[model samples]
Target: MSLHTASCRCGAIRFEARAEPFYASYCHCEDCRRASGSPVAAFVGFYTRDARFIGEAPGTYGAAPVTRSFCRTCGAPLSYVDARLPDQIFMMLGAMDAPEKYPPTVHGYVSEALPFFHIADGLPQMETSTVPRPKEDGQ
Candidate 1:
């Protein structure tokens, strides 16, 4: 896949993903909702080697051992990096220059989804904190 570029609202932070995302998901966890100030947060997952950051690396903080990066100037949440998944990164979908290019494949943390929010019926849904297990692994 060809590389795709993305940036924060103010354009102070930019990034590029070298390939199409492996998957896309919407997170309804409280931290996501609070950090994004949205009912849910959309993310596009890719391998770390497949993505690059232009300009300065954004400010980062550990939300656990996992780190969340954001544009300090604009406070736009940009990406999530985890030691457990050292090779992969999850970029905030809203930061994409063409967010339409990546559509969410699933809804996660459904138990924390807002009571008044309405999720469309067709997409797959999972209630657990982690992603669903692959069929063969039964994670």
Candidate 2:
């Protein structure tokens, strides 16, 4: 199986996803913009089981349902995980070793997109994400 590798800007944190990503998108939410320091951010989603840290785990922010992680050494944003989709991890596309291979297939949260920045890719745009999440099973 091919591995998709990624790391922080300083190489202080590394990870690999052993399986194909389930979804990839360009997000325009304010939270993502703030976390990534960009008006738009792209993320590639993988099953949590397919990804693993290469060294010490990265530092994290927020709590529970929506947590963001970053490289403590370089302060580069890394990943985001939501409890609603507990089995998936969304890694920042900019952090990937081969970002060109996993281009965003859709634009998400367009309602929140900055009016000054526009993408004319003609790809599907959604007011919210179209990525599928596993149905919750009562624990």
Worst 10 residues of 2 by lDDT: 130-139
What would the per-residue lDDT of candidate 1 be over residues 33-92, giving only the tens digit for each residue? 887889999998888888999986799987665689999898889988767677888899
Per-residue alpha-carbon lDDT of candidate 2 for residues 1-139, written as tens digits (9 for 90 to 100):
9799999998989989999999899999988999999999999999999998787689999866789999899999999999888899999999999999998999999999999999999989999866755566753
Give candidate 1's TM-score: 0.89
Q: Candidate 1: which pairs clash?
A: none
Question: What lDDT score goes with residue 10 in model 2?
Answer: 85
Candidate 1 backbone clash number: 0
lDDT of 2: 0.91
Q: For residue 137, give model 2's deviation from the true position in Å.
A: 14
